[model samples]
Target: MKKEKEIKPPIITDIQAIFDRARQAAIRSVDFERVMMYWQIGRRIIEEEQGGEQRAIYGERLIPYISEQLMPTLGSIFSTRNLIYIRQFYRTFPIANALRSQLSWTHYRSLSAISSIEKREFYLSETIKNNWTARQMERQINSHLFERLLSSTDKETLLSVARNEKQPADPKDIVKDPMILEFLGLKPESSYYEKDLETALITHLQEFMLELGNGYSFVARQKRIHLDGDDFFIDLVFYNRLLQCFVIVELKTHKLTHQDIGQLQMYVNYYDRIEKLPHEMPTVGILLCLEKNDTVVKFSLPENANIFASKYQLYLPTADQLQSELQKELSKQNVQ
Candidate 1:
């Protein structure tokens, strides 16, 4: 008969980790129950305030009466203002099952402050998508992150460009859009070339990635490949962590044609087949050109293709110009 060895307890880190998770789950359960209770209370109060027939009852005045009834026994959670917010929460989310379990009562309270249904939904979606804390969500709302991110070529990113200009880097820079380089050195004007544009983009790569979207990072420039004794080069390559895909960007000085689209599709196929891992999504290609023909693009690619052809501009338009263009675009859309 052999004596069994004693089994020791888990380490402190493991114990603490388990404890933390349990504590978080308990908090979440409590918070969810609290929110449900408030919503139900608000609903009942509203029902009581509204008379059974067309005649009115206490209406909004029942708020104070309910608060008075609950304050002594239920505590200060039943204040007039808080009751109003709770009622709004129920009305805003009529479907009881739609409440987000991950969010706490505080998150819902913060979201309830938003007036526009569309804007509120956008924030709610973004907040959950980003897994932001209440403070982070509030900060984003205050920063107008939605508006800033939606705006084309927002100026916030230029701060880095301004800093980079006062101090030159190790590498020699290329002059794109003669206008930009001229602004930098008063150099002689030259034709705007795609190569120059690509070179300039590298210097402002951070800004370019930001404009592209959240989670996009620069991967490579002039990414090269060899296939069947022929070599091909991609202008710009980016990886979006959120989208889990490689984004291939091509710069074209001329209007986009079916041939260019076919070329992009070929590159996308190359990436999807070779560069993408089993867990990664398929590659995406974007053709940024001076002009794009919608018909050519529609006819060139398969319906399921991820390649996109869009117009690009070297210069930033003024606010008024952008507004007027937006209005015209909206009008055209309405007409269509």
Candidate 2:
């Protein structure tokens, strides 16, 4: 028999990719120049207002006068309200060398609404790390993700991770206690089967991945496995790049049980033993239920197991509510 020649795949040029990169570069350059221009305007306005020899002459009417003179020349962007924003930009970021070029002016505009310096820094760092769009950044900030994450961790780890100084070592380090899914259009009282819920998640996979957090990509849904004439299916599957592991997700519309944990553990075991590469870490299983018993969670899994039981909520909670609930949980953990 003649030896067969190996067929190689064709190399395709992604002209769209090149175009997108060029587009992104152009947008970034324009955004950077716009930001610096505002910064310079603010600087000149402030310096001329305060440092001029006639310092006390126009203390009150200076801003209005500047707006009147600059608006006709600069267009609607230099309105008094935006000039205030520009002044705030200069005040917040005094050093030109330290401007975050990855972020667009829209992102900075939303971030400027944040009053706390520490929280602003955290959001800024995460925006850069996650490459979140302005809308996504605003949504995260509005969702109080920082507070929710801090609820699960101590302040130091929160700052360290936010600053990109440390990576999350455990799933719990990044997992929110009750993942929110208001975007899925499911109501808390809505009666839906597990398949229906999973379908909703798949339909809104992009938003689902966002809710999952940084570096999560969908792998499969209802993944099938067969062994000894038995057919098994996992509801949802994802790979977490940051964790370098397969994250098996099992969704339940009702309250969780030890049996659910056992089932998920079996799936995790199958992945670790058969599916995961030798270089990859053990598979991590997430049992996402509508409700769960903390005591049951503690008793069901081994202390060192990578599996976790987390609850899911249909609606977004108020910042105050999440903060208070997180504080109580932290206090309870400390007591334990």
Candidate 3:
């Protein structure tokens, strides 16, 4: 007698793979091409209603009546709020060819909230090209990315700046002086030790990583290192995917000193000699301190040093202070 064949159990990984592919395909489908479609629809609706006249009552009573009727047939999809959004979307993005497919409806909705047309356009273009999810888009917007780029570079250089896919070539590019750590909920004037700051950073690691810039992956905290029967603990360790290197960060709650820099260098050397992969770049060390002397830092490292020192603030710096500093930098660049 032939034996009955045994059935294999379904694998969760395989099921998840299928689900992910289906989800991606659905997102890519034009079943509801989001804001772009709505904008076009609204534009067409307006044009037909106008019949080539500029003085048509497009917004007054007509839009409300049409929206009311459309809502019943369209369900919640065509509510008055969405209809208004469609109209505003068209108004915001008058150039049809300029609309990007990668941006979801939510992205467009957020973009529409920005008052400045130039700022909105910058975000729209960058978000689409970068394939940024709605949350990423929102974060960038909140970070004032467009304004920051504009302050740093000219309009012609903006696209290149936005398209940067890796860690900045210069330390200045990645470094945000007085790096904000308000998310950690620590007060600047509060009596805090290095361990306290490190703990806070660990607690808010996700936000810290984003604020740190692209490609930073948490490796270990209070990472232990042994050498010649001695034990040492590095404050935090991370790997930057874009930089392709191990990054060792040493935290200091007070003014940075040559000692801090030297310790960081030792950590960097250790990682380079042992932890770093052969294919990866040399390990980079960052001295995150409350204060730094630029002159001392320049002299402490080699001519083209991979090691860097940056100041970290427990609270958010005033917008005015940041703006003024940016303005000064822009002016100097202009002069050069």
Candidate 4:
């Protein structure tokens, strides 16, 4: 018998990409349907309980009763805890048209827990603008990212940036101080070399970029620049599309000094003069140290210099700790 002709798969460019895009679209569609279903369920529950009045008659028992009845069929997702979240999801966003299709149910659940409307709105707008995943959104909330931004940036400007009404004009608006490096899996008590810390940051570069705020793309590590006979290497180099500038980051494991500031300033000047294109903005330098003296930082750079010194922490700060820090910052600003 003649051997059967072997069939081959057709050559298709980006076949994997095609499959990934299709799967993602399917997931998004299903998630959107689930969101709408939950919203409608919540609306029905509210309408039945209220019975055309502003206040509900059933009180707390209504949700439990509904959950107890529906959970067996709908599974654990309709549990009392989740039903409450679903109810809040509807209440939080009363207008169906106001709901963003981009956000998943998980995103809404986390967002509903926020009581402050301004804070909620800020996160909502930012999540959509940044395309943050549910986990990233939760991490930002846990880290008090909103409060951190508020501490450094004007409230109106921050909100305007979130709303896409204005771009960040200054590095302080995006570059986080006391940068959180918890994702690096480093010990807070142990000492680390500058190279070690740089390695950790490079390993967790995605999380690092997220912590860096927005529009940052990694350029190089240990970026070498030759000056006359001397050679200097920057720990990390990044470009911020929003700021339209090269960002030079120097890692200092010890407390920052005037000399460290001068080194970074020189790097910034080199980039501005030689590396930076005419159309690009001036290079900005940041000194990341275990500790920074604001007074030292102030005196080290000129008033108009594009240089800053910020502290880094291995762990995420508690809300109380962040609040205290913000209060201290505000007090200093008021005094100034």
Give all candidate RMSDs, comma-separated.
15.9, 10.1, 9.1, 10.8
Q: Which digits, one per residue and each the tens of the lDDT, describe model 1 over residues 53-114?
A: 53333765578877888888988888888888888887777677888877777788888887
Give the higher-TM-score candidate: 1 or 2: 2
Highest-TM-score candidate: 3
Error of 1 at 139 (Å): 12
Off by over 4 Å in 2: 1-104, 112-144, 319-336
Model 3 TM-score relative to the real fold: 0.63
Candidate 1 clashing pairs? none
Q: lDDT for every model?
A: 0.69, 0.82, 0.75, 0.83
**lDDT score, residue 310, model 1?**
65
lDDT ranking, high to low: 4, 2, 3, 1
* Root-mean-square deviation of candidate 2: 10.1
Clashing pairs in 2: none
Clash count, candidate 1: 0
- Give Cα distance to truth, residue 272, candidate 3, Å: 1.7
What does candidate 1 score on TM?
Answer: 0.45
The list of candidate 4 runs beyond 4 A from truth reads: 1-33, 36-106, 109-144, 147-153, 319-336
Candidate 2 local lDDT, 154-270, one digit each (tens): 666755554556887887666656787888898777789998899999998988887777678889999999978999999999998888999999999889999999999999999
